[model samples]
Target: MASSSMLLSLFFTILLFFFLSPTLCANSQGNALHAMRSRLSDPNNIMQSWDPTLVNPCTWFHVTCDSNNNVLRLDLGNSNISGSLGPELGDLKHLQYLELYGNNLRGKIPDELGNLESLIGMDLYNNEFKGKIPESFGKLKSIRFLRLNDNKLTGSIPRELANLSNLKVIDVSNNDLCGTIPVDGPFANFHMESFKNNRLNGPELKGLVPYDFGC
Candidate 1:
Protein backbone atom coordinates (compact mmCIF):
# COMPACT_ATOMS: atom_id res chain seq x y z
CA MET A 1 0.00 0.00 0.00
CA ALA A 2 2.86 2.37 0.78
CA SER A 3 4.45 1.61 -2.59
CA SER A 4 1.18 2.42 -4.37
CA SER A 5 0.91 5.68 -2.39
CA MET A 6 4.46 6.64 -3.36
CA LEU A 7 3.74 5.91 -7.04
CA LEU A 8 0.65 8.13 -6.89
CA SER A 9 2.70 10.90 -5.27
CA LEU A 10 5.28 10.65 -8.02
CA PHE A 11 2.60 10.82 -10.69
CA PHE A 12 1.09 13.96 -9.11
CA THR A 13 4.52 15.56 -8.89
CA ILE A 14 5.13 14.95 -12.60
CA LEU A 15 1.72 16.37 -13.44
CA LEU A 16 2.38 19.46 -11.36
CA PHE A 17 5.69 20.06 -13.11
CA PHE A 18 4.12 19.87 -16.54
CA PHE A 19 1.41 22.30 -15.46
CA LEU A 20 3.97 24.82 -14.22
CA SER A 21 6.33 24.55 -17.18
CA PRO A 22 4.46 27.12 -19.24
CA THR A 23 4.50 29.60 -16.38
CA LEU A 24 8.23 29.11 -15.98
CA CYS A 25 8.84 29.75 -19.66
CA ALA A 26 6.63 32.83 -19.52
CA ASN A 27 8.57 34.16 -16.55
CA SER A 28 11.86 33.79 -18.41
CA GLN A 29 10.53 35.62 -21.47
CA GLY A 30 9.17 38.31 -19.19
CA ASN A 31 12.59 38.76 -17.66
CA ALA A 32 14.14 39.15 -21.10
CA LEU A 33 11.66 41.90 -22.01
CA HIS A 34 12.06 43.54 -18.64
CA ALA A 35 15.77 43.73 -19.26
CA MET A 36 15.07 45.67 -22.48
CA ARG A 37 12.60 47.95 -20.68
CA SER A 38 15.20 48.82 -18.10
CA ARG A 39 17.59 50.01 -20.80
CA LEU A 40 15.29 52.35 -22.70
CA SER A 41 14.49 55.98 -21.90
CA ASP A 42 10.71 56.11 -21.66
CA PRO A 43 9.95 59.71 -20.80
CA ASN A 44 6.23 59.13 -21.29
CA ASN A 45 6.20 56.23 -18.85
CA ILE A 46 5.09 54.00 -21.71
CA MET A 47 6.83 51.06 -20.13
CA GLN A 48 5.18 51.55 -16.73
CA SER A 49 3.24 48.33 -17.30
CA TRP A 50 6.47 46.34 -17.49
CA ASP A 51 6.45 45.23 -13.90
CA PRO A 52 8.92 42.46 -13.16
CA THR A 53 6.94 41.66 -10.02
CA LEU A 54 4.14 40.39 -12.25
CA VAL A 55 3.81 36.74 -13.16
CA ASN A 56 4.39 37.33 -16.87
CA PRO A 57 4.89 40.07 -19.50
CA CYS A 58 1.78 39.17 -21.49
CA THR A 59 -0.17 41.58 -19.35
CA TRP A 60 2.23 44.40 -20.18
CA PHE A 61 1.28 46.97 -22.79
CA HIS A 62 2.82 46.71 -26.28
CA VAL A 63 3.74 43.10 -25.64
CA THR A 64 1.85 40.32 -27.35
CA CYS A 65 2.08 36.66 -26.46
CA ASP A 66 1.02 33.39 -27.97
CA SER A 67 -1.38 30.94 -26.38
CA ASN A 68 1.52 29.35 -24.50
CA ASN A 69 2.52 32.78 -23.11
CA ASN A 70 5.57 33.04 -25.31
CA VAL A 71 6.32 36.63 -26.33
CA LEU A 72 5.44 37.07 -30.02
CA ARG A 73 5.30 40.80 -30.78
CA LEU A 74 6.60 44.14 -29.47
CA ASP A 75 5.04 47.21 -31.10
CA LEU A 76 6.72 50.32 -29.71
CA GLY A 77 6.97 52.44 -32.87
CA ASN A 78 7.00 56.25 -32.68
CA SER A 79 6.63 56.32 -28.90
CA ASN A 80 9.37 58.94 -28.62
CA ILE A 81 11.57 56.55 -26.68
CA SER A 82 15.28 57.06 -27.20
CA GLY A 83 18.12 54.66 -26.41
CA SER A 84 20.22 51.98 -27.97
CA LEU A 85 18.89 48.44 -28.28
CA GLY A 86 20.20 45.81 -25.90
CA PRO A 87 21.47 42.37 -26.81
CA GLU A 88 18.94 40.94 -24.38
CA LEU A 89 16.28 41.49 -27.10
CA GLY A 90 17.68 38.46 -28.86
CA ASP A 91 16.30 36.36 -26.00
CA LEU A 92 12.81 36.73 -27.42
CA LYS A 93 13.13 33.60 -29.50
CA HIS A 94 9.47 33.59 -30.44
CA LEU A 95 9.34 37.25 -31.42
CA GLN A 96 7.75 37.89 -34.83
CA TYR A 97 7.06 41.60 -35.17
CA LEU A 98 9.67 43.91 -33.62
CA GLU A 99 8.60 47.42 -34.62
CA LEU A 100 10.79 50.17 -33.16
CA TYR A 101 10.75 52.55 -36.15
CA GLY A 102 10.98 56.34 -36.13
CA ASN A 103 12.76 56.55 -32.82
CA ASN A 104 16.07 58.17 -31.94
CA LEU A 105 17.79 54.87 -31.20
CA ARG A 106 21.48 54.88 -32.05
CA GLY A 107 24.02 52.07 -32.12
CA LYS A 108 24.90 49.03 -34.17
CA ILE A 109 22.06 46.64 -34.82
CA PRO A 110 22.82 43.84 -32.43
CA ASP A 111 24.09 40.65 -34.09
CA GLU A 112 22.07 38.75 -31.53
CA LEU A 113 18.87 39.83 -33.29
CA GLY A 114 19.76 37.33 -35.99
CA ASN A 115 19.11 34.58 -33.46
CA LEU A 116 15.36 35.21 -33.71
CA GLU A 117 14.58 32.66 -36.41
CA SER A 118 10.86 33.20 -36.04
CA LEU A 119 11.04 36.91 -36.87
CA ILE A 120 8.72 38.10 -39.65
CA GLY A 121 8.88 41.90 -39.58
CA MET A 122 11.79 43.97 -38.23
CA ASP A 123 11.45 47.73 -38.71
CA LEU A 124 14.26 49.98 -37.43
CA TYR A 125 13.84 52.84 -39.90
CA ASN A 126 14.30 56.56 -39.36
CA ASN A 127 16.75 56.10 -36.53
CA GLU A 128 20.36 57.11 -36.01
CA PHE A 129 21.65 53.53 -36.09
CA LYS A 130 25.10 53.11 -37.62
CA GLY A 131 27.67 50.39 -38.22
CA LYS A 132 27.63 47.34 -40.46
CA ILE A 133 24.33 45.54 -40.85
CA PRO A 134 24.75 42.27 -39.02
CA GLU A 135 25.63 39.54 -41.53
CA SER A 136 23.89 37.17 -39.13
CA PHE A 137 20.59 38.65 -40.37
CA GLY A 138 20.82 36.17 -43.23
CA LYS A 139 19.72 33.54 -40.73
CA LEU A 140 16.26 35.09 -40.50
CA LYS A 141 14.60 32.52 -42.72
CA SER A 142 11.12 33.47 -41.61
CA ILE A 143 11.57 37.19 -42.19
CA ARG A 144 9.17 38.85 -44.62
CA PHE A 145 9.48 42.59 -44.13
CA LEU A 146 12.91 44.00 -43.24
CA ARG A 147 12.96 47.79 -43.38
CA LEU A 148 16.11 49.51 -42.14
CA ASN A 149 15.78 52.61 -44.32
CA ASP A 150 16.92 56.13 -43.37
CA ASN A 151 19.57 54.86 -40.96
CA LYS A 152 23.33 55.33 -41.18
CA LEU A 153 24.29 51.67 -41.59
CA THR A 154 27.38 50.90 -43.66
CA GLY A 155 28.83 47.81 -45.36
CA SER A 156 27.73 45.55 -48.19
CA ILE A 157 24.35 43.86 -47.92
CA PRO A 158 25.14 40.33 -46.84
CA ARG A 159 25.02 38.04 -49.87
CA GLU A 160 23.48 35.49 -47.53
CA LEU A 161 20.26 37.56 -47.42
CA ALA A 162 19.62 36.35 -50.97
CA ASN A 163 18.97 32.92 -49.48
CA LEU A 164 15.82 33.95 -47.58
CA SER A 165 13.00 32.52 -49.76
CA ASN A 166 10.25 34.11 -47.70
CA LEU A 167 11.39 37.71 -48.06
CA LYS A 168 8.73 39.83 -49.81
CA VAL A 169 9.42 43.43 -48.87
CA ILE A 170 12.84 44.92 -48.17
CA ASP A 171 13.77 48.58 -48.03
CA VAL A 172 17.33 49.56 -47.18
CA SER A 173 17.05 52.93 -48.85
CA ASN A 174 18.76 56.05 -47.47
CA ASN A 175 21.51 54.04 -45.77
CA ASP A 176 25.24 53.91 -46.48
CA LEU A 177 25.29 50.36 -47.92
CA CYS A 178 27.80 49.55 -50.68
CA GLY A 179 28.46 46.77 -53.25
CA THR A 180 26.34 45.30 -56.03
CA ILE A 181 22.86 44.09 -55.10
CA PRO A 182 22.38 40.35 -55.10
CA VAL A 183 20.38 39.32 -58.15
CA ASP A 184 19.33 35.94 -56.76
CA GLY A 185 16.31 34.70 -54.79
CA PRO A 186 14.01 37.38 -53.29
CA PHE A 187 16.30 40.17 -54.41
CA ALA A 188 15.28 39.46 -58.00
CA ASN A 189 11.80 40.79 -57.30
CA PHE A 190 12.86 44.01 -55.53
CA HIS A 191 12.99 47.30 -57.49
CA MET A 192 15.56 50.10 -57.54
CA GLU A 193 13.32 52.20 -55.27
CA SER A 194 13.79 49.61 -52.59
CA PHE A 195 17.49 50.45 -52.65
CA LYS A 196 17.30 54.16 -53.49
CA ASN A 197 19.59 56.87 -52.03
CA ASN A 198 22.26 54.33 -51.04
CA ARG A 199 25.85 54.07 -52.29
CA LEU A 200 25.08 50.84 -54.16
CA ASN A 201 26.56 50.71 -57.67
CA GLY A 202 23.60 48.72 -59.00
CA PRO A 203 22.49 45.12 -59.49
CA GLU A 204 25.00 42.35 -60.16
CA LEU A 205 25.43 41.66 -63.88
CA LYS A 206 26.49 38.09 -63.21
CA GLY A 207 29.86 37.29 -64.85
CA LEU A 208 30.33 40.75 -66.39
CA VAL A 209 30.69 42.63 -63.10
CA PRO A 210 32.05 41.42 -59.77
CA TYR A 211 29.45 41.18 -56.95
CA ASP A 212 31.61 43.21 -54.55
CA PHE A 213 32.83 45.64 -57.20
CA GLY A 214 33.93 48.97 -55.60
CA CYS A 215 32.47 47.96 -52.23
Candidate 2:
Protein backbone atom coordinates (compact mmCIF):
# COMPACT_ATOMS: atom_id res chain seq x y z
CA MET A 1 0.00 0.00 0.00
CA ALA A 2 2.82 2.46 0.81
CA SER A 3 4.57 1.81 -2.49
CA SER A 4 1.35 2.28 -4.46
CA SER A 5 0.69 5.63 -2.72
CA MET A 6 4.22 6.79 -3.49
CA LEU A 7 3.76 6.11 -7.20
CA LEU A 8 0.48 8.05 -7.27
CA SER A 9 2.11 11.00 -5.50
CA LEU A 10 4.88 11.10 -8.13
CA PHE A 11 2.36 11.05 -10.96
CA PHE A 12 0.37 13.95 -9.48
CA THR A 13 3.53 15.99 -8.92
CA ILE A 14 4.50 15.53 -12.56
CA LEU A 15 1.05 16.58 -13.70
CA LEU A 16 1.18 19.73 -11.58
CA PHE A 17 4.55 20.70 -13.01
CA PHE A 18 3.35 20.25 -16.56
CA PHE A 19 0.28 22.41 -15.98
CA LEU A 20 2.36 25.16 -14.39
CA SER A 21 5.11 25.32 -17.02
CA PRO A 22 3.17 27.62 -19.32
CA THR A 23 2.49 30.05 -16.51
CA LEU A 24 6.17 30.12 -15.68
CA CYS A 25 7.05 30.87 -19.28
CA ALA A 26 4.54 33.71 -19.41
CA ASN A 27 5.75 35.23 -16.19
CA SER A 28 9.30 35.25 -17.46
CA GLN A 29 8.06 37.22 -20.45
CA GLY A 30 8.37 40.31 -18.26
CA ASN A 31 11.45 41.28 -20.22
CA ALA A 32 9.33 41.82 -23.31
CA LEU A 33 6.86 44.00 -21.40
CA HIS A 34 9.68 45.93 -19.83
CA ALA A 35 11.13 46.58 -23.24
CA MET A 36 7.82 48.10 -24.36
CA ARG A 37 7.72 50.25 -21.24
CA SER A 38 11.25 51.54 -21.72
CA ARG A 39 10.65 52.85 -25.22
CA LEU A 40 7.81 55.25 -24.42
CA SER A 41 8.56 58.52 -22.65
CA ASP A 42 5.80 58.74 -20.08
CA PRO A 43 5.93 62.47 -19.43
CA ASN A 44 3.17 62.48 -16.84
CA ASN A 45 4.35 59.36 -15.03
CA ILE A 46 0.84 57.94 -15.08
CA MET A 47 2.27 54.53 -15.76
CA GLN A 48 4.27 54.71 -12.55
CA SER A 49 1.61 52.46 -11.11
CA TRP A 50 2.86 49.62 -13.28
CA ASP A 51 5.46 48.10 -11.04
CA PRO A 52 7.40 45.22 -12.54
CA THR A 53 7.95 43.78 -9.09
CA LEU A 54 4.27 43.04 -8.88
CA VAL A 55 3.14 39.44 -9.06
CA ASN A 56 1.98 39.81 -12.63
CA PRO A 57 0.74 42.35 -15.15
CA CYS A 58 -2.75 41.14 -14.36
CA THR A 59 -2.51 42.98 -11.08
CA TRP A 60 -1.49 46.21 -12.69
CA PHE A 61 -4.12 48.89 -13.03
CA HIS A 62 -5.47 49.29 -16.58
CA VAL A 63 -3.90 45.95 -17.54
CA THR A 64 -6.04 42.89 -18.08
CA CYS A 65 -5.05 39.28 -18.55
CA ASP A 66 -6.64 36.15 -19.88
CA SER A 67 -6.91 32.68 -18.41
CA ASN A 68 -3.40 31.88 -19.57
CA ASN A 69 -2.05 34.98 -17.81
CA ASN A 70 -1.39 36.65 -21.12
CA VAL A 71 -2.06 40.35 -21.53
CA LEU A 72 -5.42 40.96 -23.15
CA ARG A 73 -5.96 44.68 -22.64
CA LEU A 74 -3.89 47.81 -22.06
CA ASP A 75 -6.03 50.92 -21.67
CA LEU A 76 -3.99 54.08 -21.24
CA GLY A 77 -6.45 56.57 -22.59
CA ASN A 78 -6.10 60.22 -21.61
CA SER A 79 -2.80 59.45 -19.91
CA ASN A 80 -0.73 61.97 -21.82
CA ILE A 81 1.83 59.46 -23.05
CA SER A 82 4.08 61.06 -25.66
CA GLY A 83 6.50 59.57 -28.21
CA SER A 84 6.54 56.96 -30.91
CA LEU A 85 5.34 53.40 -30.69
CA GLY A 86 8.22 51.08 -30.02
CA PRO A 87 8.63 47.86 -32.00
CA GLU A 88 8.67 45.93 -28.74
CA LEU A 89 4.86 46.24 -28.63
CA GLY A 90 4.85 43.41 -31.15
CA ASP A 91 5.89 41.02 -28.43
CA LEU A 92 2.43 41.09 -26.93
CA LYS A 93 1.19 38.29 -29.12
CA HIS A 94 -2.04 37.75 -27.21
CA LEU A 95 -3.14 41.34 -26.82
CA GLN A 96 -6.79 41.83 -27.71
CA TYR A 97 -7.68 45.38 -26.60
CA LEU A 98 -5.47 48.47 -26.76
CA GLU A 99 -6.95 51.89 -25.96
CA LEU A 100 -4.70 54.94 -26.02
CA TYR A 101 -7.17 57.61 -26.94
CA GLY A 102 -7.21 61.26 -25.81
CA ASN A 103 -3.46 61.36 -25.37
CA ASN A 104 -0.65 63.37 -26.94
CA LEU A 105 1.00 60.39 -28.64
CA ARG A 106 2.74 61.43 -31.85
CA GLY A 107 4.15 59.66 -34.89
CA LYS A 108 2.68 56.98 -37.11
CA ILE A 109 1.09 53.84 -35.91
CA PRO A 110 3.74 51.14 -35.86
CA ASP A 111 3.61 48.51 -38.58
CA GLU A 112 4.72 45.96 -36.03
CA LEU A 113 1.25 46.19 -34.45
CA GLY A 114 0.14 43.80 -37.16
CA ASN A 115 1.90 41.05 -35.24
CA LEU A 116 -0.87 41.09 -32.66
CA GLU A 117 -2.99 38.47 -34.37
CA SER A 118 -5.35 38.17 -31.46
CA LEU A 119 -6.22 41.84 -31.23
CA ILE A 120 -9.95 42.59 -31.35
CA GLY A 121 -10.27 46.26 -30.32
CA MET A 122 -7.94 49.19 -30.93
CA ASP A 123 -8.70 52.83 -30.09
CA LEU A 124 -6.12 55.55 -30.71
CA TYR A 125 -8.43 58.44 -31.37
CA ASN A 126 -8.10 62.14 -30.53
CA ASN A 127 -4.33 62.15 -30.67
CA GLU A 128 -1.71 63.92 -32.75
CA PHE A 129 -0.53 60.92 -34.80
CA LYS A 130 0.55 61.48 -38.40
CA GLY A 131 1.51 59.45 -41.46
CA LYS A 132 -0.32 56.79 -43.40
CA ILE A 133 -2.02 53.82 -41.88
CA PRO A 134 0.31 50.90 -42.33
CA GLU A 135 -0.58 48.39 -45.04
CA SER A 136 0.15 45.63 -42.55
CA PHE A 137 -2.99 46.54 -40.56
CA GLY A 138 -4.92 44.51 -43.10
CA LYS A 139 -3.64 41.42 -41.33
CA LEU A 140 -5.72 42.12 -38.21
CA LYS A 141 -8.35 39.62 -39.25
CA SER A 142 -9.79 39.26 -35.80
CA ILE A 143 -10.19 42.95 -35.16
CA ARG A 144 -13.74 44.08 -34.47
CA PHE A 145 -13.36 47.76 -33.55
CA LEU A 146 -10.67 50.09 -34.89
CA ARG A 147 -11.01 53.79 -34.07
CA LEU A 148 -8.40 56.35 -35.16
CA ASN A 149 -10.61 59.38 -35.55
CA ASP A 150 -9.95 63.02 -34.75
CA ASN A 151 -6.23 62.88 -35.41
CA LYS A 152 -3.83 64.69 -37.72
CA LEU A 153 -3.08 61.63 -39.87
CA THR A 154 -2.66 62.20 -43.59
CA GLY A 155 -2.62 59.87 -46.58
CA SER A 156 -4.96 57.75 -48.59
CA ILE A 157 -6.95 55.03 -46.93
CA PRO A 158 -5.30 51.75 -47.73
CA ARG A 159 -7.48 49.32 -49.67
CA GLU A 160 -5.61 46.66 -47.79
CA LEU A 161 -7.64 47.55 -44.67
CA ALA A 162 -10.69 45.93 -46.22
CA ASN A 163 -9.07 42.61 -45.43
CA LEU A 164 -10.34 42.69 -41.87
CA SER A 165 -13.07 40.11 -42.35
CA ASN A 166 -14.39 40.46 -38.81
CA LEU A 167 -14.26 44.23 -38.48
CA LYS A 168 -17.59 45.69 -37.44
CA VAL A 169 -16.68 49.28 -36.53
CA ILE A 170 -13.99 51.50 -37.99
CA ASP A 171 -13.88 55.25 -37.37
CA VAL A 172 -11.24 57.19 -39.35
CA SER A 173 -12.97 60.56 -39.45
CA ASN A 174 -11.60 64.06 -38.78
CA ASN A 175 -8.23 63.40 -40.37
CA ASP A 176 -6.48 64.69 -43.48
CA LEU A 177 -7.00 61.42 -45.35
CA CYS A 178 -7.77 61.51 -49.06
CA GLY A 179 -8.34 59.27 -52.06
CA THR A 180 -10.98 56.68 -52.85
CA ILE A 181 -12.70 55.36 -49.78
CA PRO A 182 -12.78 51.60 -49.71
CA VAL A 183 -16.29 50.24 -50.10
CA ASP A 184 -17.23 46.57 -50.12
CA GLY A 185 -16.93 43.88 -47.55
CA PRO A 186 -17.87 45.09 -44.08
CA PHE A 187 -16.98 48.67 -44.99
CA ALA A 188 -19.92 48.97 -47.33
CA ASN A 189 -22.42 49.08 -44.50
CA PHE A 190 -20.76 51.75 -42.36
CA HIS A 191 -22.47 55.17 -42.18
CA MET A 192 -20.88 58.41 -43.35
CA GLU A 193 -19.92 59.21 -39.78
CA SER A 194 -17.09 56.72 -40.07
CA PHE A 195 -15.28 58.84 -42.67
CA LYS A 196 -16.55 62.31 -41.90
CA ASN A 197 -14.44 65.46 -42.23
CA ASN A 198 -11.91 63.83 -44.54
CA ARG A 199 -10.76 64.76 -48.05
CA LEU A 200 -11.91 61.39 -49.38
CA ASN A 201 -13.33 61.28 -52.90
CA GLY A 202 -15.14 58.20 -54.08
CA PRO A 203 -18.54 57.04 -55.25
CA GLU A 204 -18.49 54.69 -52.28
CA LEU A 205 -18.65 57.62 -49.87
CA LYS A 206 -21.80 59.79 -49.78
CA GLY A 207 -20.22 62.39 -47.49
CA LEU A 208 -21.31 63.10 -43.95
CA VAL A 209 -25.01 63.62 -43.63
CA PRO A 210 -26.25 66.64 -41.72
CA TYR A 211 -25.71 65.95 -38.06
CA ASP A 212 -24.67 68.22 -35.22
CA PHE A 213 -21.31 67.10 -33.78
CA GLY A 214 -22.02 68.92 -30.57
CA CYS A 215 -19.38 69.14 -27.90
Candidate 3:
Protein backbone atom coordinates (compact mmCIF):
# COMPACT_ATOMS: atom_id res chain seq x y z
CA MET A 1 0.00 0.00 0.00
CA ALA A 2 2.89 2.37 0.82
CA SER A 3 4.41 1.68 -2.62
CA SER A 4 1.13 2.66 -4.30
CA SER A 5 0.99 5.89 -2.26
CA MET A 6 4.55 6.80 -3.29
CA LEU A 7 3.71 6.16 -6.93
CA LEU A 8 0.62 8.39 -6.70
CA SER A 9 2.66 11.19 -5.10
CA LEU A 10 5.21 11.07 -7.91
CA PHE A 11 2.46 11.18 -10.52
CA PHE A 12 0.87 14.20 -8.90
CA THR A 13 4.20 16.03 -8.80
CA ILE A 14 4.74 15.42 -12.49
CA LEU A 15 1.22 16.54 -13.32
CA LEU A 16 1.65 19.74 -11.29
CA PHE A 17 4.84 20.60 -13.11
CA PHE A 18 3.24 20.24 -16.51
CA PHE A 19 0.23 22.30 -15.43
CA LEU A 20 2.46 25.16 -14.20
CA SER A 21 4.93 25.16 -17.06
CA PRO A 22 3.07 27.73 -19.14
CA THR A 23 2.64 30.02 -16.20
CA LEU A 24 6.31 29.70 -15.42
CA CYS A 25 7.20 30.66 -18.95
CA ALA A 26 4.91 33.64 -18.80
CA ASN A 27 6.49 34.76 -15.56
CA SER A 28 9.91 34.57 -17.16
CA GLN A 29 8.79 36.72 -20.09
CA GLY A 30 7.25 39.13 -17.58
CA ASN A 31 10.52 39.38 -15.71
CA ALA A 32 12.30 40.25 -18.94
CA LEU A 33 9.87 43.11 -19.57
CA HIS A 34 10.16 44.26 -15.97
CA ALA A 35 13.89 44.46 -16.45
CA MET A 36 13.31 46.87 -19.33
CA ARG A 37 10.93 48.98 -17.24
CA SER A 38 13.57 49.27 -14.56
CA ARG A 39 15.99 50.80 -17.07
CA LEU A 40 13.69 53.39 -18.60
CA SER A 41 12.62 56.82 -17.37
CA ASP A 42 8.85 56.92 -17.53
CA PRO A 43 7.53 60.37 -16.81
CA ASN A 44 3.93 59.62 -17.76
CA ASN A 45 3.52 56.55 -15.55
CA ILE A 46 2.55 54.60 -18.64
CA MET A 47 4.32 51.58 -17.28
CA GLN A 48 2.43 51.54 -14.00
CA SER A 49 0.77 48.30 -14.90
CA TRP A 50 4.05 46.47 -15.27
CA ASP A 51 3.84 44.91 -11.86
CA PRO A 52 6.34 42.12 -11.49
CA THR A 53 4.28 40.52 -8.79
CA LEU A 54 1.77 39.39 -11.39
CA VAL A 55 1.94 35.85 -12.73
CA ASN A 56 2.29 37.22 -16.25
CA PRO A 57 2.59 40.48 -18.17
CA CYS A 58 -0.64 39.90 -20.03
CA THR A 59 -2.44 42.38 -17.79
CA TRP A 60 0.05 45.17 -18.35
CA PHE A 61 -0.92 48.30 -20.22
CA HIS A 62 0.54 48.89 -23.69
CA VAL A 63 1.30 45.19 -23.90
CA THR A 64 -0.64 42.60 -25.81
CA CYS A 65 -0.50 38.86 -25.57
CA ASP A 66 -1.75 35.83 -27.44
CA SER A 67 -4.37 33.37 -26.25
CA ASN A 68 -1.69 31.38 -24.53
CA ASN A 69 -0.55 34.50 -22.63
CA ASN A 70 2.65 34.87 -24.61
CA VAL A 71 3.66 38.44 -25.32
CA LEU A 72 2.69 39.55 -28.85
CA ARG A 73 3.12 43.31 -29.16
CA LEU A 74 4.50 46.28 -27.27
CA ASP A 75 2.96 49.61 -28.28
CA LEU A 76 5.04 52.20 -26.47
CA GLY A 77 5.53 54.58 -29.36
CA ASN A 78 5.82 58.31 -28.57
CA SER A 79 5.17 57.67 -24.92
CA ASN A 80 7.91 60.05 -23.77
CA ILE A 81 9.87 57.13 -22.38
CA SER A 82 13.61 57.32 -22.88
CA GLY A 83 16.24 54.67 -22.42
CA SER A 84 18.40 52.24 -24.32
CA LEU A 85 16.70 48.95 -25.16
CA GLY A 86 17.77 46.02 -23.06
CA PRO A 87 18.93 42.65 -24.33
CA GLU A 88 16.36 41.01 -22.09
CA LEU A 89 13.77 42.06 -24.66
CA GLY A 90 14.89 39.13 -26.75
CA ASP A 91 13.09 36.87 -24.33
CA LEU A 92 9.75 37.76 -25.82
CA LYS A 93 9.88 34.90 -28.28
CA HIS A 94 6.30 35.40 -29.46
CA LEU A 95 6.57 39.15 -29.96
CA GLN A 96 5.38 40.35 -33.36
CA TYR A 97 5.43 44.16 -33.19
CA LEU A 98 7.90 46.37 -31.35
CA GLU A 99 7.04 50.06 -31.71
CA LEU A 100 9.32 52.48 -29.88
CA TYR A 101 9.46 55.38 -32.30
CA GLY A 102 9.86 59.15 -31.65
CA ASN A 103 11.71 59.06 -28.39
CA ASN A 104 15.07 60.12 -27.03
CA LEU A 105 16.42 56.59 -26.94
CA ARG A 106 20.13 56.28 -27.71
CA GLY A 107 22.80 53.59 -27.92
CA LYS A 108 23.29 50.73 -30.34
CA ILE A 109 20.33 48.59 -31.26
CA PRO A 110 20.90 45.43 -29.29
CA ASP A 111 22.17 42.58 -31.45
CA GLU A 112 20.24 40.23 -29.19
CA LEU A 113 17.05 41.45 -30.85
CA GLY A 114 17.95 39.18 -33.74
CA ASN A 115 16.54 36.38 -31.65
CA LEU A 116 13.04 37.71 -32.25
CA GLU A 117 12.35 35.36 -35.12
CA SER A 118 8.59 35.96 -34.92
CA LEU A 119 8.94 39.72 -35.27
CA ILE A 120 6.85 41.24 -38.07
CA GLY A 121 7.12 45.00 -37.69
CA MET A 122 9.98 46.84 -35.96
CA ASP A 123 9.68 50.64 -35.88
CA LEU A 124 12.53 52.52 -34.19
CA TYR A 125 12.54 55.66 -36.29
CA ASN A 126 12.96 59.30 -35.24
CA ASN A 127 15.12 58.44 -32.26
CA GLU A 128 18.75 59.02 -31.32
CA PHE A 129 20.20 55.54 -31.86
CA LYS A 130 23.75 55.12 -33.15
CA GLY A 131 26.21 52.42 -34.22
CA LYS A 132 26.08 49.88 -37.01
CA ILE A 133 22.91 47.95 -37.76
CA PRO A 134 23.37 44.49 -36.36
CA GLU A 135 24.21 41.90 -38.99
CA SER A 136 22.24 39.45 -36.87
CA PHE A 137 19.06 41.22 -38.01
CA GLY A 138 19.32 39.16 -41.17
CA LYS A 139 17.95 36.33 -39.10
CA LEU A 140 14.59 38.04 -38.79
CA LYS A 141 12.98 35.87 -41.45
CA SER A 142 9.44 36.94 -40.59
CA ILE A 143 10.14 40.68 -40.51
CA ARG A 144 8.26 42.74 -43.06
CA PHE A 145 8.40 46.41 -42.12
CA LEU A 146 11.73 47.72 -40.83
CA ARG A 147 11.98 51.50 -40.39
CA LEU A 148 15.12 52.91 -38.77
CA ASN A 149 15.15 56.33 -40.38
CA ASP A 150 15.93 59.74 -38.82
CA ASN A 151 18.53 58.52 -36.36
CA LYS A 152 22.24 59.17 -35.93
CA LEU A 153 23.39 55.70 -37.02
CA THR A 154 26.54 55.29 -39.10
CA GLY A 155 28.43 52.48 -40.87
CA SER A 156 27.80 50.68 -44.09
CA ILE A 157 24.42 48.99 -44.37
CA PRO A 158 24.83 45.31 -43.63
CA ARG A 159 24.88 43.33 -46.86
CA GLU A 160 23.19 40.46 -45.08
CA LEU A 161 19.95 42.45 -44.99
CA ALA A 162 19.44 41.42 -48.61
CA ASN A 163 18.42 37.99 -47.33
CA LEU A 164 15.10 39.19 -45.90
CA SER A 165 12.88 37.91 -48.69
CA ASN A 166 9.68 38.91 -46.88
CA LEU A 167 10.82 42.50 -46.34
CA LYS A 168 8.36 44.89 -47.95
CA VAL A 169 9.03 48.38 -46.59
CA ILE A 170 12.50 49.30 -45.33
CA ASP A 171 13.49 52.93 -44.73
CA VAL A 172 17.01 53.67 -43.53
CA SER A 173 16.82 57.24 -44.71
CA ASN A 174 17.92 60.41 -42.86
CA ASN A 175 20.74 58.64 -41.05
CA ASP A 176 24.52 58.82 -41.49
CA LEU A 177 24.83 55.50 -43.37
CA CYS A 178 27.48 55.23 -46.09
CA GLY A 179 28.35 52.83 -48.91
CA THR A 180 26.32 52.03 -51.99
CA ILE A 181 22.82 50.75 -51.29
CA PRO A 182 22.16 47.08 -51.90
CA VAL A 183 20.44 46.48 -55.26
CA ASP A 184 19.49 42.84 -54.95
CA GLY A 185 16.62 40.98 -53.29
CA PRO A 186 14.07 43.21 -51.57
CA PHE A 187 16.28 46.24 -52.06
CA ALA A 188 15.83 46.06 -55.83
CA ASN A 189 12.19 47.11 -55.52
CA PHE A 190 12.70 49.86 -52.92
CA HIS A 191 12.61 53.48 -54.10
CA MET A 192 15.52 55.91 -53.81
CA GLU A 193 13.49 57.99 -51.33
CA SER A 194 13.73 55.09 -48.92
CA PHE A 195 17.52 55.53 -49.00
CA LYS A 196 17.54 59.33 -49.16
CA ASN A 197 19.09 61.94 -46.81
CA ASN A 198 22.05 59.71 -46.06
CA ARG A 199 25.63 59.60 -47.35
CA LEU A 200 25.02 56.54 -49.56
CA ASN A 201 26.92 56.76 -52.86
CA GLY A 202 24.07 55.13 -54.81
CA PRO A 203 22.70 51.69 -55.65
CA GLU A 204 24.97 48.70 -56.09
CA LEU A 205 25.82 48.39 -59.83
CA LYS A 206 27.01 44.80 -59.46
CA GLY A 207 30.36 43.93 -61.13
CA LEU A 208 30.72 47.22 -62.93
CA VAL A 209 30.99 49.28 -59.73
CA PRO A 210 32.10 48.23 -56.28
CA TYR A 211 29.21 48.14 -53.76
CA ASP A 212 31.39 49.55 -51.00
CA PHE A 213 32.95 52.33 -53.10
CA GLY A 214 33.36 55.68 -51.28
CA CYS A 215 31.72 54.26 -48.14
Considering every candidate listed, which one attains the maximal lDDT? 3
Question: Per-candidate TM vs. native?
Answer: 0.93, 0.80, 0.94
Q: What is the C-alpha lDDT of each candidate?
A: 0.92, 0.81, 0.92
| Cα RMSD to the true fold for all candidates | 1.8, 6.9, 1.7
Tens-digit lDDT track of model 3 for 144-176:
999999999998889889999999999999999
Superposed Cα RMSD, model 1: 1.8
Off by over 4 Å in 2: 1-20, 204-215
Q: Please give me the total number of clashing residue pairs in predicted model 3.
A: 0
Q: State the displacement of the C-alpha of residue 83, model 1, in Å, after optimal TM-score superposition.
A: 1.1
Preferred candidate (TM-score higher): 1 or 3: 3
* List of clashing residue pairs for candidate 2: none
Off by over 4 Å in 3: 1-7, 208-210
Rank order (by lDDT, best first): 3, 1, 2
